[model samples]
Target: MGLLTIVTAAAVAGAGYVRARDAIVQRAQDNAVIETTNRVEQLYPLPARVFDHAALERIAGRVSGREGSAIAYGDGISAGGMDPSVITGELRSLVSSGRVGWQRVSYAGAVWLVVGMQLRITADGSSRSSGVEVYVLRPFTSEIEVVNELARNAWLIGSAVLILALGLAFLAARGVLRPVRELQLAAWQLGQGDLTARVPVRGRDELASVASTFNSTASSLEHHVGELTRMEADARRFVADVSHELRTPLAAMTAVTDVLDAETASLPGVAGQAARLVNRETLNLTRLVNDLIEVTRFDSGTAALALDDVDVAEVVRTCLRMRGFTEVSASLPDGVRARLDPRRLDVIVANLVGNALRHGAPPVSLTLSVAGSVAGSSLEILVADSGPGLPESVLPHVFARFYKADSARGRSEGSGLGLAIAWENARLHGGTLTAANRPGGGALFTLRMPLGGDA
Candidate 1:
């Protein structure tokens, strides 16, 4: 827009300058012609009285002295200071043919007005030529100076107009784009989850209307989101309450199931099968309840870390040993110690290794490493299994509670809360738990914990 304005201004300025210059030149030319004609009328009568070259020279000299001009006469000679050759042959011929002629010429770095007049004598009955011509040279320096000054002023005024127009264009663009920039920023904030973000209303323009509409939309979104948040909180509280209430009955059931498990081998075939099923189901239910409590603690922000300087490799080994994972392959680096929550770290390792053992192929591997600078270091634990890697559809939701990837598998083998619990425990220790597919065609889970003892 600024460029367009400058171009348009330049074209207008150019046209104005041309018109002004032409008018100035025309006025100067007219003034010069009028002054020359008046001088010729005064001098023509004196030249007609004389017939010889000497008398014509005297008359020409008198005219030069009176008018402060240069005068010449005859074919190519002059009595005054001017040269006869300065007058062109065409102007001389026209004067000899009884016609007045004038021309503007440049000489000696100054503009000159040259006029040609024929001297005529009225005899007793006829008018006859005296064979003498008068040519006047008048310098129009002052008029040329005036025209030049006008040209300079025209350029200066045109330039100022162009600059002022450009400045106004810039100001207008700024005024228009300011509201658009504000709207863009408000939209970005709203996208970033700031439901309270809104633009300010200004004048009663289109932009103001847009700002008012935006504010209204933001208010509606905030109200709806507030209601949804309240409902979600209520649901979480209900789950926490139900899980807490079931603990007492589940404890008694666990005790009864333990007794049934001890007597299952001595029962009859059908009864033994029923007893085993009940025992397994009771254990699964107990694990599910515990997992729910743990998740609630995380959701409520009540989960905390108990930092201790412990050997990370030792913790990994102990977790595997407690779980009776004898066939699991392990790679440990000696003296790999870190400040972390021992209990949470144990849970993270146990769940990852246990999941691999249950769902993945044999020859599961565990690796431990330390990384980063001395002041900001971390411990990384990698657990990999030689089983089919997770399906693309299941990888994203692998840590979601009760998310079973294989629907064909009944609920007898394991609870689906293991990975989710593991992820929460890692987060409680200011760490991250991620799952991926190994290069050799298996599932890999990585646990990274900060060594700075921060939760």
Candidate 2:
């Protein structure tokens, strides 16, 4: 826009400069013509005598020798075979009744103002043929020089005006566009899930109004986000309280159900069958409630890590043993030890193995390796399962709380909070949890934990 404005202004200024210079030059030419006529009338006197063509030519020659004169003529006959004169007798015959007029013409590449006048006077008390036609010419070069100088100055002034206007227009455009750039950046941040983005109000104009509106929108978004976080916290707290309350009754129910199952061998009726179903369901319910309470504790920020130097290979074997699994293969290095909370490490391994076992095929591979640091080590604990890998849609949000891959397929025996809790535990230990599809066909869960005691 700035370049366009500069170009337009220059064009207009150039055209105006040309028009003004032309008009001025033309007026100078007109004035020169008028001045020449007036000066000729004042400087030369009309002669009176009965002169022939030769006498008239001699007198014209004398007058033409004067300064600022180009051509002069008289009306008479010449001596060369036929009568000859610039303003000849035949030409004078055409002006018998009145004085002749003058005209402007070009000669020798210069403008000339020509004046022709009929001279009439009495000589020796006799009105003889003494009047002659006289002409005087003046050059307009001096006047043209003045006009050219004025045109040069006009061009300079026009250039200056154009440059000034262009600079001012550029500044105005930048001032208007700067705030728009800031607003664009703020909007980009907001789209990337940064709700705190806002623009500052600068003045009491339309742009300022826009800034005010943007700030109001950001404020509303922040308020709603805070409200949602509070509601989520309350919901988790309720789940935690309810799960704790169910623990007492579930413990008693588990003991009673166990006694009934032991007497199943003595009975062969519907009552024993119903008792076995009840016992199985109660045990599943107890595990679900325990998972819920653990997740709630993590959400409420009450979870803590008790760090200790422990061999990672032992941790993996212990987790597998707790789930009644023995045939394990590991690529754990000898000194692959980590400073981590042993109990949380157990939970992370348990959840990852349980998830893989349910959704994947057998012969899961567990790898514990040391890399990246010697003094303050980093451990990579990878659990790879042979199953259909995670679908693309559910890969990114696999660690989100209560987010099931296929909710309509009914919940798995392992609660959805398992992966969520594992992810939280990894973060608490200054680590990260990642999942990806294996090359052959399966999914791999990797827990990368920082092994420094400070973490």
Candidate 3:
């Protein structure tokens, strides 16, 4: 914008300068022509009456004294202060055509206005040339200087106007962009979880309308999010309450199932089979209730880590032994000790091995290693089973609660909460659990726990 203003102002200034120069030169020429014509009229009658060269030179000297001019008589004698050649051919031609004329010419690094007139007299009632030619040379350098000064002033004013316009445009843009910048900042804050973020409203322009709409939308979003958060909290509290409520009765039922398990083998054929079935179902129910309790603890933020320095390989061996997962193979480092929650680690291993045993093929593998540096080291555990690998669509949601890969098999041996509980336990120990397909055609679950004892 500033550049455009400067260019436009320059063009206007140039045009103004040209017009002003032409007017100044024209007015100067007109004044010079008038003065020369008056002098010529005053001397023409004298030259017409006396045709002698010496007398004409005397009269011309009297008429143009000290001025740079030239006079020519009919008999071809001439007198002037200016060079005779300074009277151009064009001017002489116009005078010979019996017309008063003027022209501007440059000579000796100076500008001059030349005016010419031809004198005539009547003889025998016919008009004939007396051949008294008068020409005047007037310096126009001073008038040109005045015009140049005006042009300089025009350019100066144009530059000042351009600068002023640029300043005003910047101020206006700043005023417009300030509110937009504020809106951008507010949007970034909102995206970063600042629900109360809002922009200020200033005026009744379109920008003000945008600000007002932004505030309105922010308020509505904050209200809706608050409601959603409250409802989620209520749902979690309800689940936690129900889990707590069921624990007492579930304990009594667990005691009854234990007694039945002891008597199942001694009972008759049909009765024994029914007893075993009841015992198995009762244990599955107990496991489900226990898993629900653990999930509630995780959700309520009450789950905490109890870190201990333990050999990771020994812990895996002990968990596999307790779970009777004898067919699963283990590849562990000799004495890979880490600062971790031993109980949580046991839970994670049990769930992964149990899931593999129930849903995966035989020949499961557990690999444990120490990873990262001493200052911020980690324990990485990979549990894989030689089963059909997880479907591509189900792999991402493997750790979600109650997600089943084989939805057609609605009644599975273990509760769906196993992997979810394992995932929460891993996170409680400042670790992560990720599931993927192993290259050899199996589901792999990897657990990484920070070994810094910070959990």
**Reference-based TM-score of each model:** 0.83, 0.66, 0.84
Off by over 4 Å in 3: 1-18, 46-78, 83-135, 268-274, 300-302, 372-377, 428-430, 453-455
Better of 1 and 2 by lDDT: 1
Of the two candidates 1 and 3, the one with more favorable TM-score, higher being better, is 3
The alpha-carbon RMSD values of the candidates against the true structure, listed in the order shown, are 3.7, 7.6, 3.7
Model 1, residue pairs in steric clash = none
lDDT tens digits by residue: candidate 2, 50-115: 566676655455444343442333443422221122333543454444455444456667755544
lDDT of 1 at 290: 80
Better of 2 and 3 by TM-score: 3
Error of 3 at 215 (Å): 1.5
Descending-TM-score candidate ranking: 3, 1, 2
Model 1 poorest ten-residue lDDT run: 43-52
In model 3, pairs of residues that clash are none
Q: Between the candidate structures 1 and 3, which one is better when assessed by lDDT?
A: 3
Q: TM-score for candidate 3, please give it.
A: 0.84
Give the range of the ten consecutive residues with the poorest summed lDDT in model 3. Answer: 41-50
Q: Write the per-residue lDDT of candidate 1 for residues 349-415, one digit (tens) a residue.
A: 8888888988899889998888786658788889999999899999999999888899788877667
**Candidate 2, after superposition: displacement of residue 114 in Å?**
11
> How far off is model 3, as Cα RMSD?
3.7
Indicate which candidate wins on TM-score.
3
